[model samples]
Target chain A: NAGVTQTPKFQVLKTGQSMTLQCAQDMNHEYMSWYRQDPGMGLRLIHYSVGAGITDQGEVPNGYNVSRLNKREFSLRLESAAPSQTSVYFCASSAGGTGVSYEQYFGPGTRLTVT
Target chain B: LAKTTQPISMDSYEGQEVNITCSHNNIATNDYITWYQQFPSQGPRFIIQGYKTKVTNEVASLFIPADRKSSTLSLPRVSLSDTAVYYCLVGPDYGGATNKLIFGTGTLLAVQP
Candidate 1:
């Protein structure tokens, strides 16, 4: 399996600019998540999807939106970029089922800089 | 989800065993303790996980006490490459869908020669 893959390894956007971060997983996982990590800090969830067509807000869901068009794809959209949103973003997926281990597979993070 | 507390930083010499402990006082009955390791600019990788007692894998070992309030991640025979931030997460094991995982500022382990 290719595990999880994220697009645009790095991006820089100006204030009020909008962009979408792409996340894809080939593990056929039922759960997918988007997280942001600030320098020297742990990750905070932005959004998540339990399955296709289902999305939910996470701890820090403000300034962001998400969509799960299919089981293998989840996208994070930023309506208006802000400097505070400049951080490394990560996409992760996990198989969800009874008696299954809850280990998340993470993709290479996307580094975003909002000027 | 339960909050986790761990050391901010730890130092160890090469070839020595390193133990990083995380405290979760409000862990629920269905919650499991998991550990993840991350190097610079890379994604975090699963190291080990355990509910109670001990869980041993090829890479590391996870030890939880009977109360399951705290867990320790033991890395044996550490090397320079083992230097990274270690995260301890506690969350319920939902049967079909997992709730969000809260990642606090993890313990940064610096390995020295």
Candidate 2:
């Protein structure tokens, strides 16, 4: 299986620009999450979905939005990208939700730069 | 979410055992300690997790004290490929949000071959 995959491996955006980063998992996992890694910082949760049609805000959800249209996809949208928004974006999936026992599988990560 | 404190960095030699300790003094009684390993350009991967006592897997071993306030991730043999940042997370092991993990500043383990 392909596990979790994210699109747009690299992107360079100008301030005020908008873009959507796509994520998908073949594992049929019921949980998906988005996180951003800043320099010298730990990953911060952006948004998450427990299943298709169920979404929730996470620790750092101010600059982003997410939707779970189908079970296999969880896309992150950055509206009005700012220089502070530049960071590595990662998509992860887990086997279950509500204290699921399995480990989280992550994507390679998308390198984003807002100049 | 309980806060976790781990060494910002560590250095290890090849073939040596590396144990990275993490402290979570305020860990909730039901919280579980989970460890994740992240490469320079990748997402964090789950290494091991435990609530109490020790849990061993092929990748690493997680040692949690009876009080559940601390945990140690033991890497049996160090190698160049093992050099990466390790994250310690604390949360309910079951019956909580599946992916609401609080990843704090993790320990950067540098293994020199």
Docking quality class, candidate 1: medium
lDDT of each: 0.90, 0.88
Native-structure RMSD, model 1: 1.9
Calculate DockQ per candidate and list them.
Answer: 0.52, 0.59
Best by DockQ: 2
Question: Which digits, one per residue and each the tens of the lDDT, describe model 1 over residues B68-90?
Answer: 98999999999999999999998
Across all candidates, the chain A TM-score values are 0.95, 0.95
Please give the lDDT score for candidate 1.
0.90
Candidate 2 lDDT by residue in tens digits, A13-110: 99999999999999988888899999999888888888899989888999899989999999999988999999999998887663424588999999
Q: Estimate each model's TM-score.
A: 0.95, 0.95
